[model samples]
Target chain A: MIRAALTLFLALATVSPLWSQSDLKKLSDSEITAFDSKLKSRSQATETLIADFRQEKSMEMLKNKMVSKGVFKYKREDKIAFLYSQPMVYHMIINGQKLRILSNGKNQIIDLKNNPVMREVRTLIAASFLGNLSQVGTTYKISYFDNKGGVVVVVVPQSRQLSSVITRITIYFKGSNAEIERLKIEEGSGSVTEYIFTNQRINTDLTDEDFRIN
Target chain B: MRISGLISSILLVVSLAGCSPLLKEGIWLQNTPFAAGNVPYVYDTIPSTQIFDFTLVFKKSEVTGIVIIKTAGAGERRIVMTSVFGMTFLDFELKGENIKINYCIEQLNREKVILLLKKDFEILFKPDHSKITKYLYSSPDRLDALEQGNGITKTLMKFTNYNNKWPETIQIEHPYLRLSLLLKKTEYDPESI
Candidate 1:
């Protein structure tokens, strides 16, 4: 009897958890509406998002997983700053009209209108987080998939210009409030960056200094 | 006719002088273009995370990113620089003598800019030993190589603080192109996390 129990335990241990994860099924119209409504209502209550995030980057060039850890702050309307603390301190922020990058103690302000590529990227990140995937013009072909636990929305860029850099973006949503669990960005040049959120506190009050560009 | 013959002879002598074979003859070997001052490091091909204060001089703009170099793997040498936002600025591979660009953003993807980038990496990674006609050691830590051409391109490399056969710092000066790269070392291990 002990031997049988031991065999069963080993079988459970050996079985991969991947099978248990969501298998991304087509959501019905009602399901999509429900998700949209849930996102809209929750985003209303949640004015600020403060989360400790882990970013995993894999490329053809990287022999090992290029892992980077950082903190992310997001405010409604349009304000987000991703500050990478591990390995070094570098900040990428989008506050108001300027797109700012702080690296190696030097700050640079780039106009968003002149650069279409970064403009699209900024759109991609913002729209994905808010769950309003269709807000970023008509350049992307968006699709929605849902599992028992969460929903995965895949956004594929159709434009020749945007497609050169970003191939697709997958946003995974979980929890009843439709919290953004993970975001995966695949580049056309054979690289993937996955941002996983942890310790995500909703409705946290963040000041303007928190999202300062400089 | 005699004066013309004298001029031709002088020209011939000058051309022959330009082709002097002994300029780069001493201890000539493959892959030692400027001839490294000492043995180079045998770093793990996995590539440690290297962050340099990157600057595109003519553009007069500077941004920083982690410069990743994967030398030990198969195919060409892969170099990737990404911002803190996880945005990739430059991604390319060096295969033999040619560089195959996988992707470069629109900002740095101009024809002339791409050509300069190709030349810059070539200068940084590959020594211009083919054009090198002279090599002199200014100091134990400094080595200067002179390339013979209409305009001799001088490459000055200083490796002062080296431990474990690795250069702690590397500086490259391209006279024609007002470009300089300063790479500083840092501890980058992805597996630890």
Candidate 2:
């Protein structure tokens, strides 16, 4: 479950920056293609994405926000790692379709193919990295909204398996080349997990060993 | 002859069924009188919510996750546990005398697991013993949640690692089931409602 959630969350968080336009005004077909191309080109230009993330999780039950700090590394093509440093130490590696977690000094490896939900997440991550926003329609009933902060993309799961666990995912993006500033995941109950990214740096040097499993 | 044989086998099965541990171990009772002075118990912090770094110990293995407990819209309370990967293990709720389990993983859906969890969560969530039975307090600084049946299962859920007006941890254990939960690093927050 942790593998699936972290994978989906990170995939969505990373992909949120791939939408080009934040405006709501109706655009010509040419304008839409041009906008999509701009985001696609910018995303492809980068070899890696390295960012320091401050994740503040607000649950319906707790009054104080659950805050943690971590480093996020996404090497182009197919490898990503998220290492948590505060409150606790955890390392998660996603190489190809395999997910590995090192926690409690024990390492757990899971195959995305064997776990359907995780496979969906794997597909989502790949689509996001490939800048295929249109493919999301295959799994989710998506709607776009215009907000003061930016454009909000609300995705409701179309697949029965995914819907049983997660209700919806809402991402807030801003600017002409929309940068995903925040994302909120709503679960089966009324609980919500909101993630906000900060100090994002793109096209950095990240090595293969960083994504190795035990 | 066939009918008689079938009846005898059925009788033997029923007779042996009564010897099962769950039926023979005695039913769990929830009327423990335990209290803390001015400390924020689960129900005391009413309409409030908290998140804990949750760890569960099975007989053969252990799993770590986060548990979120919040009061539902009604007078009800809900507890949700998820794997670090975000997959949910269970979603349980207590509303009046009715305890509703919205969902739980198949492996944890055993009769023994549910029964013990029901009792442990009751002590953790509804901890107002002002009118219930009383506890044999061990210390001035420590508070405990007590369950009595066969000799008294006085595990740490019975004891609170407490701070001034705050509880740092609630450790619950079912010795027979080899199930234990260490709910640690509690952060007292404002009202979630």
Fnat per candidate:
0.36, 0.07
Give the worst 10-residue stretch by lDDT in candidate 1 chain A. Answer: A15-24
Model 2 chain B, poorest ten-residue lDDT window?
B23-32
- What DockQ does model 2 achieve? 0.13
Question: Candidate 1, residue B72: CA error in Å?
Answer: 4.0
TM-scores for every predicted model: 0.75, 0.65
Tens digits of lDDT, candidate 2, A113-214: 766665665555444445555566667876656566355667788877677667787766554665556657776655566656667788766788888865
- Docking quality of model 2: it rates as incorrect
Best by TM-score: 1
Please state the error at residue B36 of candidate 2 in Å. 17
Report lDDT per candidate.
0.66, 0.62
lDDT string for model 2 (B13-73, tens) is: 7876543332122222232222324322433344656567777887866677777777664
Steric collisions counted per model? 1, 12
Residue B97 displacement (Å), model 2: 3.2
